[model samples]
Target: MAIVTMIRRDVLTLPAAELGPDNPLPPLRPLDEMHRIEDRDKEDLPGDMARQIGYAPLHSLLPVRVRDGYGRTRAPRDIDTLVIENDRLRATVLPGLGGRIASLYHKPTGRELLYRNPVFQPACFALNGAWYSGGIEWNIGATGHTTLSCSPLHAARVTAPDGGEMLRLWEWERLRDLPFQVDLWLPEGSDFLYVGVRVRNPHERPAPVYWWSNIAVPEECRVLAPAEEAYHFGYERRLRRVPVPSYDAVDRTYPLNSVHPADYFYEVPDGRRRWIAALDENGHGLVQTSTDVLRGRKLFVWGTGTGGRRWQEWLTEPGTGGYCEIQAGLARTQLEHVRLDAESEVSWLEAYGPLSARREGEWAAVVRGAEAGLDAVLPRAEVEAAYAAWRPCADTEPGETLAVGSGWGALEVLRTGDKLPGTPFEESTLGDAQTPWLQLLRSGSFPEPRRVTPSGETLVAPHWRDMLESAPAQPLTEYHLGVAQWHAGDRAQAVRSWERALQLSTSSWRLLRCLAVADREADHHERAADRYAEAFDDLCQERRDDGESWTAATAALGHEAIEALVATGRITDARAVWHRLHPATRRRGRFRLIEARLLLAEGKREAARAVFDAGFEVADLREGAESIGELWARITDEPLPAHYDFRMRPGHDDRPA
Candidate 1:
């Protein structure tokens, strides 16, 4: 084994002899057959791994080392030694163990990173050792990471030598992320990695699944993205809950929450890989993954900020931690909802990128096996116009940025008069399973007898009012109430309701999710992040391979809420709900540009450029310059015509309207 040691910031390479560059090629296996690899193996194998034997082989094993202008290694000195051999690569510690490996040839920019070795490497085994047997392979760009990995079965796996570890991989297999193609490429010399999860799935059968990635950061450190609209969440006194805020921007330099039990979900879309990099923000030589894009995948970032002074600022409390995973991914058990099937192959998901600290780039996701025609997708123009129209009215009227909401939207719903009625409280005695909360109330169990009487002018509903008032409330109910409030125009009341709900339910992943919604509305991204993490755990458990509540009625409501969230630039949050909720909840949009608008918000010049560059992408309105046009139209009752004299654009046509 090559022993590479570094006391400085220079990059180092491991010798071939020590790296076992000539080890027997991994047996050719099919993508489906490799699903045996476990998450732990997936994390440690390529980087921070000791033996290359665990990884399977590709068509070629080209070996190379990374260096800078001075012929010095370009990677961080602390990053053990990274060795790339053809399609297979390995990393070993100078004085430690293993490290992360990057794809040598195929790299995609503005998209989430998905190392194939763990999922597709071994799949070549079943193809008589042919790496691309029944699969398709294409190059993204010179510096781009490998982006295309599709399977005949829509499933990929990774296994250990002794059959110890196992993990499964699936994407766009069932027509989910759709109407667009997965474009993974990188701009050479850029400091950030760009990846995107496109949508190409047909609108016929939308499939939803809980999504997340298990990311392993190279070092312990702080995350420096943007706090202008951050939604922070984490354990409160060791409880799994989150807090939601309203239009509040945090000024802390780094992430405030510690890294003990790290996890979260973003309300953004999976779009062009934006700024997903591990920068030593504090110049502490720390590495962190900026994005973990899994449509419906939970987001988890765990690390110790308590170790160094830079980190300490982020984590002010005693239990402030680090040294673990600045990571994110869905829990294993939550994999049920995500499935590989025929009708679902066309369902697509789009994720946005972090263009700037304050905003993110959007993604146009397409289904897996649907037609390649452009008509099947949502155009970029509509997305821009929608964003422009959906911005908060206060934001549109400068000096009008008034306190309009509590975190949850309850007040908004009540004030706007769009609040949906919760189950009637008088029906609490109806325990026939034919009514809502009948079983729980009949059995005197939790979340039972959801109902409430209208006190004077206040209308109370079962899941809404009772759940909100109950000592141990129901997160879903709070979210609904907040949604109603937002619809009703009581924005400030909704924010307050959601924020209060966040403090009440720490163990409830549902609460975490509600917090995400409220945070997004209030424009408090830090708090939204916190709630997203908690919701991730719940999402995993709720949806998996084995389907559970697929009823039409429940699905419809879920779809409506998800669409509303997405229209407002909460792509990640909408995706999470889409994955967990049943088909009834899936809403097929005439145009999907919420993600692109978010990219504009992040200040990703390239990403925004790409959105505008796409011949089919155009915007109709200029949403107060603070929002995208498409997003604005979708959210509020605005006069966003299909075409406007001021660079008017079509809602669905990528061409300028």
Candidate 2:
């Protein structure tokens, strides 16, 4: 019953590219067919996805196919429903219109929780459970459907966001190295056992519906989305799965059975895609989901506690207990994608089993062409090697929205959603509560974890801080409060909170980036540069199957900053700061235009020109860069242009400049 909203920070509509044309580039190798499909433009325009476009599930143009030169198609299996039964529980997977698990009926207690893993953070379900209670995990919203599973094949339920019939089953099929073919494993005990629904577009114009699988799960879970690194809420983790953080009763208390402090918010490189697999404590399989398929995917690991860990707690509702869900993807899509076109069909796959589902000792899922088999085992080395070729975008790109200098300086804006370029908080604010406490925290105070006395009174302010200091400050709470403070306008306070947070938590690249940004904002350029550099080092250390692009991007940003200082004729300052920065932070987009300016300053006019010529005009100068309107005076050498209009930035409108 949650409202999910997708801000198309990176949403892009790619025009369909003609396929099957003879010999454009060297003919794609017959063995590398998957690569060809990826290169091909999507049939459905990859437009900016936002709130659910329509109630119906999203579909594709035609049945995706996977063709191996050897006459093999790595397609996923079709199933009516994948039932996972064991001593403790029973659940089923039904594929439907959207590639998701239709229903999750916890038979042990007759309590059914329907959700998806839009972004794969644990503590998904039982938000109102009787265990840990806090709004930490409530950062995301529920969309049309949520998929569930411990393997490549997912189980999901397609629900009516507007309170109508809410149930459907689905799974995704993929040929080894090809796009996925979603297979609807029709629901059981219902009329949709084998029949797939072809949803029609109800509105005349395209509608944008926010949809994502709200995967509900316990607090003691972790993810493996291979990216530069994974962040919870905004905190990062070191390991994919770690022990749950202990609940510090002295900090601010939330609802029991809730994921507080740390909420998994996986940061994937733009245009990169891949699947994330989740495992339990015993290293046994638990759940896995994927990001977009075109770019090589990466894993985002998130949890609570020191390092990357989760806070162990039980999920008990009015009657049920110990349940959770994971969410994945942005919440919205254009109505066109949701309303099934007459000839369009959407497909995916879902498979599940107890901890002992697969006994062959193979511990991974393969994503390829349409053909996907649960029991299929290809060379693990080959999978990693093939995927490793692709790199991810840097996580430090300008916020989602970007407005480069138009060809004519026409003030052109390419907007997907309301987020500013290079901003990450836009997505993190999704489902977070606008509570006064949260509001105050967002403003400046980094609230420590809640503390409850023996009599059970929630602590706040001085008392909360006292409790946090008395015991170990919960990393998640500290980070959440720090972010809250940052949003609330106390940049200095937020920086302090994050510094304290870093002491207890380790292994989050995003946090490292945040620390860098926070220090920069405070004009502590040396510290910020150092932090960014450290993030790059950590990124290199945690290099997984995917995510080099983002790492590169981070480095790019740092370098950009240095380049900017140098361009503005501050070489000595730039060099001093650059030296202080870690090698990783010095590599990529850290200072995009700033670098160009620096090159210009150093009299490397051609190099500077190259930097500018390489789509530098298109560079997102909005992040710390002065806005066009702000720069008008400088550029015009006169009063503001008469035709120019100005307004404050979205979230900063009311704040002082």
Candidate 3:
């Protein structure tokens, strides 16, 4: 056998609900608003590194749509998958779901190298929202998981460096407005899977770039990286440098030894190879190595604490085993974004496979053995040579189309008239989502929908905003123009635009919600609450079961309205709005929390406590959020339960109520 290399289409029967309609609200908050990690505890950092942490910050997620529409409800559904395989290894990639490598199997040992998530549970983990845990995830565009974590990406067949058929995944990262591609191939009879990744800047100005290859490995493995010191970022929102492997007298190399979820960013030296590994006691497990352009290496461990275990259960089925993430990135840490100059592209090749290290004296001894093992089998120079061979192939046109991504890429291409080599965002791929913007690009005016159903995607790019400004001053145009103005940091202009839209009969609930956010940001809480209440009412009245998309918008708006009302001491009105919510929406875990908040606001402490006793899970709880824990503390003085104890650090009392 000449080492079989082929790609095939397959189906996976999973209990996953479709990520329903994306939230219609333009993401008003900055991407890092909740993160608040800049210059955090910088006393322990090098001066240069501290400066990079705050550089090139993204103000908001304007052009990208939020994907909070998915719910906990799931049924047996067929999910499409593509398998790229050679004789020694087989990799399953979900092209429709962010081109996620769902599983990688080593054929000879009958072992799974990556954490193969047993269930498809959509949680609020990705940057835009919906995210599932498992396998090798290609994270590009910005920090956290890419907005494309649960979205589709274009996939096609291309010639590999070894003359084998490779699976290529490409997408337009809307937040950064960059085109990127990931090529997956297993060379003839090779144990390691090769990945070629490229991110290109087609614009005239410089742009910040962030890329991380997040690989999920089983917790049974010990994480190893080439560094003596590591920068630790805990959920407490603190960053400090600490010794590797033996931090706080607990060998941090073992994922389970710690008691909280945290990230250990290894400071790979200027001349060292970029690599990280998770290996078992027998020293046989997955190792990831990359070329120089990808500089960062990290180990994200959800440790042995109850909260970590609970998060593990929350991300998948309750009984599934826990896992850790070994990631490689372009900066020293995920919190930092490197600047990519105009018309420049960054490219690198990464290889992942099983390695055997036959030594076990200490952490250093184990890491040295692992490095020796890697060099003996697949040397660092070989990886560099492979990257050199793949450089020219990166520009080769895609051969056969396997899947299609969002039409936003094609719309961008239409507006900019830039041909992204290799990753073609063809005109034929345009769809309903791109209709209004496409019309604006061609006719020089945005077409207004007949019904004020709060439908259609919003575009906030400068080019689109300029076109909207030039278009007729219709309510729709003004509404979108306000969003663009807000994104451009012009709050006064944004307010004027929304007010102008409201002057017309075609004004909508979506416009009202945007104005409410502006008011809230401006510290006009009472006025903001009124706008939120009105927006929710209008949204509910107009939602004629219009579709799942409308329902998601309704739920989002209602949630915001209730929070505002409760915060402003409008308990009676909040209750009224809560009752007006659809029964199904009221049954959601997040809604249950809202109901508890309402109970507490109404002076029913015992009832609010009973809500926790009833045992509900907020499936979409954020990583660093203290909302649930804080609410529990407010309701009672008792110790938090194992299921609810997700605190990653101390000083809970210091947090504001």
Candidate 4:
């Protein structure tokens, strides 16, 4: 029989903020009260454009105390961990963290098939920030980590047909206003773990539905899949193309030996088998094979460099080692900008387990073995037999229920109708702050400044202020309030709020940078310079502490700080900061333009011109080259070089650069 049970264990404890004397759990404000009229007016527009308008109310406005990277401490806390076991494999799930698979162990070799992060360390990696590395993160509704990534999910244990055990986790994806469920089954004596996923849209209108299972494995592993080309995204989301495995005179194989990091999304050849595997040099690794429901495959590489290592540390911890991700998506690519029709549901099954191969050539053989074994073990007759022999086990809890004889092992999931305590945001009530905020956040658009009502009569500011007042000590609350205040043209008050936020959470690079921007916009040049300098220093410290190489985000922040210093006539300080940037960042066209500008300001026209010439020769410039070239021409009063190509590159379409 499959073993399934839930246990609470102390893993990681995060810093907790104290709520004021006011009630910690306040009544959720209705959506109408929470959102201004502008939010509703923009509802008819496409989802992606609406999110950009920034009309969504900020639900995280409530203050919660959290410690900085240095001051934070980790302790054990009781979190429910679901354990599912069979003769060949054992798996664990953390229902509290979006029902994320915490561990998948192959009992035969006693090796972990999935990377299991020992600690619950969160870093500023996800779109909304606060992403934890390792395991499989179920991303639905919008790209990056979904709003539910770090949130808890409803869970249950049920007896599958044929006495097999199943662990089910379900949650309402507020951003998409849909419900998603995942069922994991481990039949007795089977080597593979079966994962069935269902996403339902009960609404009347069609909406975009995105799903990606992000699976992490050890760094330096080779990923085997059927793909001919891969799209690479560089700093600032620059897109490029190269052949899969070996491309563009560079080896694109996994567990890369290259000095530079790589981030790319690959589309599988149409009609190819839906399978991907990451095998170490020894041929022991993890394999994920899904039904036709999942069609896209992706590979992300964080090179073995100082910057990459530091990023690894931030996501996990020191000495825990780094990992890479092999992702599977439902659409042709990630969040394919598509929509799901109303009152429809999409479901699929995926199988995952350990794959053992002793040599590189045997990788395909291993995959074949897994495929054959799956077919043999879970044939239609076997499934029918299992369904007929199903019986409730003693471990079956009351909250967990089961259905039999459903097509393709389908089970009926009863919504718990339970509201998550303490936060009104996850409640399904239309009037709750989450409804409109989620609608805006998921749409990828925000209202324009002119569309919003006058700052004095703003609808969201008062609610944010109320939350801040109720949790005066929470830094995040202050941060949100500062954002609202800034939008209201209260720059001074915004600065004050941001300053308090920084004081409370010194390690928050986002807060520091926002404060710096506010200072810069307010014409407080020296203050802005100081803030930028401090932020840069913090980034450097993190790099040093984590042994990470320079990242594009940090480099961009550094560039901003140095520019601020230069603006303040602190050329010497700017030079020091510029020199400290990584060599690769220094070679970029954007930084070169800044360098030329700096040289021209210092009255070295020839040096500036030489810098500009060199930059134009080597840098692709992508989309930004024209603007930088224009600025260069303005600075030097000279024409752009004849050889410089301002036209877009073949693979570099208008993405983010």
Candidate 5:
């Protein structure tokens, strides 16, 4: 049977704000206040390995904008989805949402190979703030999650090497300024679905590259990789080498063997086919294998802990059971960023299918059977040959535009007519976000949108930075240039830029907020609070209710300003900022939490208790954040609800009586 592809409607609920417009402000929090959640830092040892781990740690996500505009409300809306199907398998892709393969269903077995998240609930997991769970997530860019986790990608039909139709998802990764594509197809009479990935650097500079195909699998399986030693990183923020399959006298290959969240990056040695499988007791589960260049394989288990279970529940709806990640990446560890030199590309072919049941009994036997099963389906030699076959196909132009992604790539290509053969970020794809940049590209000047509003974007790419630097000076220009400079780690120049921007427009709340962030990072809490208060007040002073897009900015500034005031023990000032918020904005879940914080700061335990009693949900509450539960316990004489208990540490959770 021939492969078929079509766009269908899926109810896109759970991402309440419709994965709303990105926060106009850059997403960098004060470094001092930012808890280092990722534990990819090297362990202290007397070796060059330790030195290598620190080689190019991403200090900041400067060029990329934060995606925090999505909220927790779950209103249903229609979203277009591209579905590709064959007689044997069916794959559903969300081009509007990071090109996530939302489902891979086996027709013969009637099983969902990947975790099919019933809802699109986004949490604060991506490098950008909003990230949802389940399916196959293609993570690229510097560590953590990709900024594209919730963003759309350019999707279209392309001719496969076998003359079949394939769905291609391409996007310009502005974080690294690289164009990449993922071509997915299922061959006729073949059980294994083929995925060809290519990332190209059109620029003349060495770019740090990271790619990980993270597949969410059910926890009711044993994850087997081609390594006996694994780098284990747990919630305590420590990386230690431990034995795979069995670590600390427990066989951790089973996802339930642990009690906390952890990453087991397998040490897939040289000459080994890079593959990992999550096989059930009967050795029937999903197997993912790729060619040599996509080298790393890993198993990320949230473990059997309550926090882990709670996180699983939070990402989807409660009672979705649990799932772990079996990932394939371009590096041994997610912390390590491989260098893709100037004008080069890296391409690989990956195959994913159900591992045939081996009828093995022991765990060791089941693992070996799993490996043998993969070899039977798609041998390493065949995978390498598939990579060779897909090389010329990588240059195949997209046939029909199935969906659209961001216009960042089109904006870049417009600036420097770089021709990427296969993935064309077309001129027509340029949207409102790219309009300002397009004017800058054509006129070498940025439009100023600084009256009672924040700049919609704060891109800090070297080219854009240089463009802004040479543009006619304005408050917006100076403010954006300062952001670029700050991201490039030039704090002094960044501060000067913001200060000058403020000089041009004294009441520009955006400039004040940027300066306030600089002060906060420098540990000047009082000064930061003062700046934040001024910024919030300035925003309020310039409101025109006739309908301007100031509500998001006002709420954001007001939230930050109140938090800063409360943190610095200025209770009255915090209350003033809170009340200054638009009534509609104040009624939102996050602001209610802020109101509680304000009451708690003023020694009003009863008032704080009332705030919780009033029942509010902080929609964008991050994973493992126990702040709400901690606050609840501190004020109210009641046990923390299961809803707010997001504690990931085993013993630190606020369990109810």
Candidate 6:
């Protein structure tokens, strides 16, 4: 019998703002209006005619006129929500909000595993500049919350092969022109929620993408993962190793009441198996596990501070209390980008459910219990007896012993099989089936071109070319082929291969950026400038039309366009482009330095000084402060004072210390 139900209800939500040509905000210039430069030559105009026509700013302070609201108000709207329940677990999903897992409840304990927001409140957090805290958010594409999180998704209720009910939610990511779908299944009497995610690139080109599952929990909850060390980004954005749970004079194993926020990406010690958990003070919480595909586990702490609290409240409903995220990624880390080839799809299964342990050692006992409990559900005697009674067949494997032990692990093992050489299964096959290619891609150890010596002559391996020819439509194949060609000293052929790949699909901003670099190297100044401009425009347009806020790609393309314009001696055009960039991108010290350079070129000495001062203030917040300072000295031919402190300043006395 089906254990899940789908229904529509008029849930209370904060209304989205309606801003466009029909309804616009009053015209009011920003404080820095004098610094803004108009696109006199129409060089900054969007290449797409549809976007250029009837486009005007509704608010001077905002770059995109059509933006969602950032306010708390009571409004009732119909939303499709899916309810899945077993004897011990009850969960809810909101299809309208990117099919978010709105609530997860443990019926026996009468506790909510996920922090449920009382009302919908969007804040300037996600990559789309609007994110709501709580539940589990499926983020795909580039880093940060995906563009689809706030948008409506297509959902359907289907029957699993085992006759269980499943809710499948899917959407086409317009920004990258990729399609992603998540299938949520709850067996008739299982305690866990089985999540199967698949992301596909239908075009005949490779795309660099990222995927993360952000699971939210209360601030008091502590995260546990099978990792000896965690990576912390230094001031220069370079990752450095720190002890797991406790490092840098801070205890990360157990949640602390510190005012300083922290974000860490933990490397799973055993790359073969990956799992993460969050336990509350009572040692009751949820554990998520995946055998393959999802490898990276991350912990994000907001800390107890007035600013962080305010931001947390803004993201959710006020008085909901603060929460943190336990994130899992398909790549090694969120900072790492993976390539998905044309007509290729990566799929994986993740299971999350309630877990409990005695409160005696707090986190120590909780971790031990979770580790011991992962592959066991019934008593050990019962599991052993069941295993003995089971018949062995050609497909029988040692890992199949998990079937009689833990329900969750059994499903995963049966679906994927034991890790060994020359398994009957082929890796190239796609869909819900488990494949070795998915495992390789998830491990972030996909094969690369190797140098080989044949007939006393060093040559690039033919394996890369063979793969490309076999999957000519695959984007990664073309990209790798180009890399091989470049390494073989065939620069022109490499550029042609990349250009052809771009023609197949223009979704990869990285590929576009690389092509532009090749153009610059070839002394094609005009072509390089044009390519940079197109890349920048595409990134900005995605933010404007698809609600995909600024990302690393956006920052890189913005800088590339600025530098290309400066190289072409189009100073005014560069200034205009800089001003039109997303506000978040403009806040970066690197972009601020670019702005300062433009001001200096225009002989605005005082304005340039003011820009440099502003950049210095925020430099400590990001890495590359020392580099920025060095660049400043070189630009103005003046050394910085020795006494200047580049570290982050303390918060106000009124805030948490």
Winner by lDDT:
3
Residue 54 of candidate 4: its Cα lDDT?
A: 40
The digit string of per-residue lDDT tens for model 2 on 534-573 reads: 6655644554432333433334434534633543455756
Model 3, C-alpha of 477: deviation from truth (Å): 0.4
Task: Estimate the lDDT of model 4.
Answer: 0.57
lDDT of 3 by residue, 299-365 (tens): 9988766667778987887877889999999988888888889989999999998887753567677
Pick by TM-score: 4 or 5, better one: 5
Evaluate all candidate structures by whole-model CA lDDT and list the values in order: 0.28, 0.30, 0.85, 0.57, 0.79, 0.55
TM-score of each: 0.23, 0.26, 0.96, 0.54, 0.93, 0.53
Clashing pairs in 6: 205-475, 206-475, 235-623, 342-475
lDDT of 1 by residue, 328-408 (tens): 222111212332233333222221221112111211111111111211232334333322332221011111111111112
Runs of candidate 6 with Cα error greater than 4 angstroms are 1-78, 234-238, 358-366, 378-657
Clashes of each: 221, 161, 0, 24, 0, 4
Considering only N, C-alpha and C atoms within 3 Å, which residue pairs clash in candidate 3?
none
Model 6 whole-model lDDT (C-alpha atoms): 0.55
Worst 10 residues of 4 by lDDT: 403-412
The segments of candidate 2 whose C-alpha lies over 4 angstroms from its true place after superposition are 1-471, 474-481, 487-493, 499-569, 575-595, 610-657
118: Cα error in model 2, Å? 24
Best by TM-score: 3
Positional deviation of 332 in candidate 4, in angstroms? Answer: 2.8
Error of model 3, residue 555, in angstroms:
0.9
Q: Which model is ahead, 1 or 6, in terms of TM-score?
A: 6
What residue runs in model 3 are displaced by over 4 Å at the alpha carbon?
Answer: 32-35, 38-40, 651-657
Alpha carbon lDDT at 213, candidate 4: 92
lDDT of 4 by residue, 75-183 (tens): 5545556777777887877776667887898887989998878777554344333457789889876655564555567666555544445676666664455566777
Ranking by TM-score: 3, 5, 4, 6, 2, 1
